[model samples]
Target chain A: MHLDKEALDAHESRWRAQLINAVAGFKPVNLIGTIDDQGRTNLAIITSVVHLGANPPLLGMVIRPSPKGVERHTLNNILDTGAFSVNAVTEDMVPQAHQTSARYSGETSEFEATGLTPRWIDGRREPFVAESPLQIGLSLLEHLPLKHNGTHFIIGNIDCIDIPDNAVADDGTVDLGALRLVTACGLDTYHSVGSGTRFAYAKPDQPPRPI
Target chain B: MHLDKEALDAHESRWRAQLINAVAGFKPVNLIGTIDDQGRTNLAIITSVVHLGANPPLLGMVIRPSPKGVERHTLNNILDTGAFSVNAVTEDMVPQAHQTSARYSGETSEFEATGLTPRWIDGRREPFVAESPLQIGLSLLEHLPLKHNGTHFIIGNIDCIDIPDNAVADDGTVDLGALRLVTACGLDTYHSVGSGTRFAYAKPDQPPRPI
Candidate 1:
């Protein structure tokens, strides 16, 4: 099926949005954990996290515009504390991670409500999901505003990482298949990654070789 | 194993970069197609594409700072023409897609060199990979500078999309497993997605219902 801008605009706004979101295909799912000044923990499912660079070790995620002036608790906490955690949402964490999207009262903590435990570092203000196979601690490096669209691209410097010993292969790549990490499509669908296929580094005239 | 900032800095630079890149896990891989003003087609493998907003149907991709004093062909082309195409790389296209990352001269066409066909839309200068399960045409929306890290986040408005009929579900989500699409880990490993698990819309007090 082919969908042009005009055809896409013809559909209901919600339908178009979902359709557009899904067509981009599978996305890495992460549970973004943060804490407000009052010590309230916030957890939200985020699929926009992507690697930005490696030298200084940076990562970026997109924060959508809040609806009708509603408060985005996660974004607000990340901005206020300048610290956040990116936790890989595995198959087991799917239900809890999805529930984090629901709006709860200011005093209510998503960690407590969803039955996910918050693991805190000694001196850091933010928390990480205890159930995650891979967890990362980051400090806010820069946040760029997309003026054309009312979205913010938040970039952070990686300060720490936690992973299972067996998950790290000889080459340093995480064996996500063994961890059974979940990838998201559209809004609620999740998929598990299977065994990886390693290919030889592509050279000018060489065919691909299996590693 | 846990890696703090000091530990990460202690490793060899190349090893550290590879380890940091892979621990984040699977990433969506795309063949970014662009054309120079001289009508030479260029294709490069990019894993940083993330959904920004669906209302305007925007996508953002990170363009790493060029090496030393080199120019990024894909970034330069997109800036010069204000148009580009994003094509999902499938299992069969991995070799060609990966080769696009190699440094080809300005006079070389990665499309022809890699043996991938470039399918151009009517009146559109940018071309999409003919073998991609999903192809999207986009126009430049905005490019934001990341001065802290020396990177550029290129945001674009999706103008059109092409996908296989069976790949899209009735609810508007794409079935990536059916397409046998590939995801990247680190710089060389690729993985195929397994069956998807769907959940109902999350609510404050309701348990997750399977869709």
Candidate 2:
């Protein structure tokens, strides 16, 4: 199949969304937990998380603009509180995580609606998903607007991380496959990954070898 | 395991990179292809591609700063030509794709070094990886600097795409697992995903149902 910009623009909105989303391949599926100043919590499944850097432990995610007259709780809460939690969506949490995307009212928390537990650490304002095997607390660093599209690119600085001890290797690599971390492709599909192969550091003169 | 920012900051750089990278979960693995003004092609393995928007078909990727006195070929090529290709990495292409990360001299194209074919479409400046099952051509749209970590966030507008027709479903979702698309975690690990479940659009009053 060949699709040009014109062909893509001509596609039905939902269809185009699915195709475009899948073209990026497997994405990190996470439930972003946030809270408004009124203490009402919000949970939204996000698949756009991208690793930005390691030194400052930065990650970036794209948040679509809220519909006219609608409030995007996740963005608004992050802006209001400067803190949020990214909880890795595992196979067991797929249904609950996917359910969070439903249009719940501002008064209704997705955590409550979907029956997912909200975990709050001491001194933290954001709530984390207790069902998640890996939880990362982050502070909002920058919110850049992409003018081409009204989407906001939110960059966060990792403040802390909670993970199972068995999941982390001595070399510091997290065994995502062993942890059964779920990944998403299109807007609605969720996948489980197999224990992957790790290659040794590539060198100009050597063949790629598994480490 | 729980790691605070202070503890993370105290870890060795490479170890920290691995841990932080893996914490984001599975990532889309692709070979980014670019060409300099002088027609020297460069291919590098990239795992940071994120879907920015669907209508405009925008994708964003992070490029780390080059070492002092070193020219980052891929970043420079994209800037010099305003064109690039993102080719999805598949299970069969993993070894060659990984080999592209080897630090080759400016004149050595990774395509040639790894024996992967560079395919050209008429009028397109960027070369696509022929071995890749999915190929996307993108024109540089924005080059934003991430001030926090000195990384460059390059946003591109999809110009064209070439993919296998059988891989696309009627609903516009691409069957990534069936296509055997490869995903990555940490720095060197590559994974194959299982055919996942696709849930129907969520509704406030309904449980998520597989489509």
User: lDDT of each structure?
Assistant: 0.84, 0.91
User: Candidate 2 residues A50-165, lDDT tens each?
Assistant: 89888889989989855673549999999999999999998999999999988888999999999999999998999999999999999999999889988899999999999999
Q: What's the CA error at residue B114 for candidate 1, in Å?
A: 1.3
Candidate 2 clashing pairs, residues 3+ apart or interchain? none
Error of 1 at A129 (Å): 1.0
Which residue pairs show backbone clashes in model 1?
none
The DockQ-derived docking category for candidate 2 is high
- Candidate 1 reaches a DockQ of 0.71
- Judged by whole-model lDDT over C-alpha atoms, candidate 2 comes out at 0.91
DockQ of every predicted complex = 0.71, 0.86
Q: Name the regions of candidate 2 deviating beyond 4 angstroms.
A: A69-71, B69-71
lDDT of 1 at B163: 89
Question: Across residues B86-168, which tens digit of lDDT does each residue of candidate 2 receive?
Answer: 99999999999999888889989999999999999988999999988899999999999888878899999999999999998
